[model samples]
Target: MSVLVYTENWDGKFKKLSFELVSYAGKLAEMLGTTVTAVSIGSVDQAELQKLGNYGAQKILHVTGPNLDKLDNQVFSSMIVQAASKEDASVVLLSNNNSGKAIAPRISVKLNAGLVSAVIKLPVSLNPFTVVKKVFSGKAFTNVVIKTDTRVLTLSQNSFELIETGNKATIENFNPEIDTGLFKTSVKDVEKVTGKILLTDAEIVVSGGRGMKSPDNWGPIEELADILGAATACSRPVSDEGWRPHGEHTGQTGKIIAPDLYIACGISGAIQHLAGISSSKYIVAINTDKDAPIFEAADYGIVGDALKVLPELIEAVKEVKSS
Candidate 1:
């Protein structure tokens, strides 16, 4: 039995989630008494795949071509299926991010495998493998057993603990045949967010909401984030009002984050917003309205105006960092 993890890259470099997924796949490999292999398809070089040894991948299979750079559902799913077939992978892992969400199900259909998305916990085996996962928009969890030839899983970001033990492995390059006709999507300009990490993968998040009053009032939020080495996020209303980018929005309809600490400033917690961040390890809520629903989900709640509270928080964070 072999476990294969699909690694995504950016600008010919391995993304952070690549190691995370490979580390998770290594655990599955240990359980199955097999080796962990990684499959990467993009413009990345074989050297990038070779570096996956740091994450315990025994072998890396890379397929690169001009058509592989852009996201083509048909071409990517086909290539992944080909890799799984070649590797004879029993369990296939992918990160439950944008790319994973799009490709995992398609690959599952191609492989006729059972899939578990948003996987939180590792497999529990009494007899068959039982994987626990979030369901109903993270309202509850259910255990699923993959009683099939292949088990496909997409691990949720920040769900599993990343383990590091230096193990450098060999990387092999294999080029797959891509029918240029199948490449429907074209590579265009890529836009990137600057000065902040993605909230989903961030360890700490400093979020602002309507309490900031205006976009200009977000200075303290950025300062606090910089001091704490955290990402900046916003509530739905703030994004709707165009005070912040939509990508920084965190709510049910927005990005869900499970950071170690989530500090919500000036945002009255609505059920919609709480649904996105309720999985965070610890929550700190600050608002002038004591009755705000956000306080219910917070580990610590402070009833005060955000305009007054933010400056103090920023100053305190800077002081601690300097000390």
Candidate 2:
């Protein structure tokens, strides 16, 4: 039996999370005394596919066919299940992101595998195969034991480090029977926010909140993000007010993120907002109010007007970069 990781690609390029999954799967495979295999869908560069070797995939099963370019949860899940069966995968790994969230559960049901999502670490004990996972919006953790022989797990982003093994991986074509009917829903077109770090994958993120006051006031926030090479995000109320896109919102009702550094500007620390970013390695909060709830969760708290403070922060970062 082998450990199989589903490597999802976006616009023909693999995201950092995919590499992280491969590395994590490779380590687990070593612990389990099994080889690691990667299953990828759609079109990706041969060189890019080969790079999986550095992260510890011994083999890659690439599935390419018509209507596979777009993401259809049912179709993608079917493809993964078929590949896993062919590889005799005893353990399957996935990234607990948007696509993985959609496809993992379906694959689990089809394969009769016990699934654990939002897994934070490798199994503490493999005999019983107990894994730790985040619960209650990442405020707490729970250890879950998988009793099934076939197990599937979705790793939370930023929870694992990527290690290069320098081993070359062989690629094989995997053609699975496709139900043309699954293509009932097809992607007509795709829109992407180019030239910006995706929030989910960003190492550093600078976020704004209602405290920015108005959409026009976002110049400072964006400037700070640009200086730091960080992705820009906002709190729920900022999105609800149309100052920022809903996709940029981070809170219980928006996207969950765990970046290396998260800078919150003018946002009051509401529990909902904290739930989304509590996992960040370091948090910096800037607000005029000294007693804002966010200060309680912040690693570093600054009591100042964000509009005045952000420009100074940006200048300081620029000076450091120049020096």
Candidate 3:
């Protein structure tokens, strides 16, 4: 039995998320007494492909072709299924991000594999392929046992450690025979949000809510984020009210992020918001409302107006850095 991990790339480069998945797959492969095969779908450079070997991929499959750069859900899923079949991979792992969420179910159906998503840990038992993942909106975890011979798992972001190994992986150019008719979609226009830290990839996040009063008050939030090199986020209401961009929204209906440190200023922690950020290692809540729900989830709490508190917080951070 071999392990297959899908290493997603951006602009022909691998991100920390890919390394994290490889690390998880590599450790799992070790536990199962097997090797790991890393699969790359798009145009990734040889140098970038070699990096997966440092994370314990014994073999790397680089699949690139015409129209493959643009994501066609059906084609992408098909490619993974084919790779797993060729590699005889018993376990498949991918990030529980947008692509994984969309394609994992399809891969499961094609492989007839049991799928467990949002998995935070390695398997509990290799016999039945039991895995653990957060359920009930990250409030609790459940151990799911995959009864099938093959299993597909989606690892939560920032859930695992990136471990480098000495293994130098052999890279193979994989070109699968596919009917061009499957390319039902064409590239229209591509727009990217540039010059800002991506929320999902940020280790620290500074978020604010309507209590900042208006969009004008967001300068302090941005200043603090810049000082700490953190990503700026906001509660749903703040985004909906146009105080912040919708892309910065974090909650049940928005982006789910697990940062090392999450600071919520002027935000009341509704369960919806907590559902997105509850996995943070440390939470700091600053709100004037003593009974704000955010306090319950915070590792540290400060009861004060956010507008007054942010400046002091920024200054403290600067002083600490200077010291």
Candidate 4:
């Protein structure tokens, strides 16, 4: 019995979530007294794939095929199902992002295995593997046990600490024959979002709200985020008002993030927004209104204008970087 992790990549480079999943699956491997193997489809730089060994992956399987380059959810899921069936993986792990959400469910149906989403912790026992996951949109946690023959789990981003080791593993190229003609959808083009850090995998996030005054005033937020090497996020109203793209919106109806440090500026904490980011390890709220609901959930609060506070924070970060 072994743990198999599906590694997602972009443009021959690996995504940060890959290391996180590898690290997490390594822990599960230890619990089950088995080894961890990573399966990656498409063409990726060999150097990037070999780096998985640093996170405790004993073997990295690279499936090279021209058709695998483009993401067809069914194709990817079928590849994973094939690998899982051949290896008899006791547990298969995937990151709960756009890809995993689509692939895991289909794989579950194909393998007839129990599936868990947004899993935050590892299983407690092997007799009947049980995992802990978040539910009610981060409001609470639940313990679920899998009684099926196999288990498939999708972990939430930023839920586990990525472990690194100096060990390097051997990479093997796998040639699987798949009938590409059966693929239902084809990827036309990947419109990449420009950013040094991805919001889902970022350790720190600085988000703004409508209190930003106007779209033009957003320069300070970007400057501060750049200085801190953090990703920028916006509130629902800001996205609705066209101040930022809907992709950057963070709330109940938006993308959920769980960074190590979350800084909320000029936003009154709405229950919906909190539901999305409440899993952050530490939260800091900055606003002029002292009684704003954001302060209630913040680990630290500053009663000041965002315009004034952001620049100071940027300067402080610059000084720290310079030192």
Task: Give the TM-scores of the predictions, in the order they appear.
Answer: 0.94, 0.97, 0.97, 0.96
List residue ranges in candidate 2 displaced over 4 A: none
Give the winner by lDDT: 1 or 4: 4
Clashes of each: 0, 1, 0, 0
lDDT of 1 at 295: 91
Higher-TM-score candidate among 2 and 4? 2
Q: State candidate 3's TM-score.
A: 0.97
Per-residue C-alpha lDDT of model 3 across residues 200-268, encoded as one tens digit per residue: 999999999988999999999999999899999999999998878899999888988999999999999
Residue pairs with clashing backbones, model 4:
none
- Please provide, for model 1 over 258-278, each residue's C-alpha lDDT reduced to its tens digit, 9 standing for 90 to 100: 999999999998888988998
Candidate 2 yields a Cα-based lDDT of 0.93
TM-score for candidate 2 = 0.97
Ten contiguous residues minimizing lDDT sum, candidate 4? 173-182
Which sections of candidate 4 miss by over 4 Å? none
Residue-by-residue lDDT tens digits, candidate 2, 1-323? 99999999887888889999999999999999999999999988889999898899999999887777788999899989999999999999999999889989999999999999999888998979899998899789999999999999999999999999999999999899888887667677878789989999999999999888999999988888888889999999999999899999998889999999999999998999999999999999999999899999999989999999998999999999999
Candidate 1 vs 3: which has more TM-score: 3
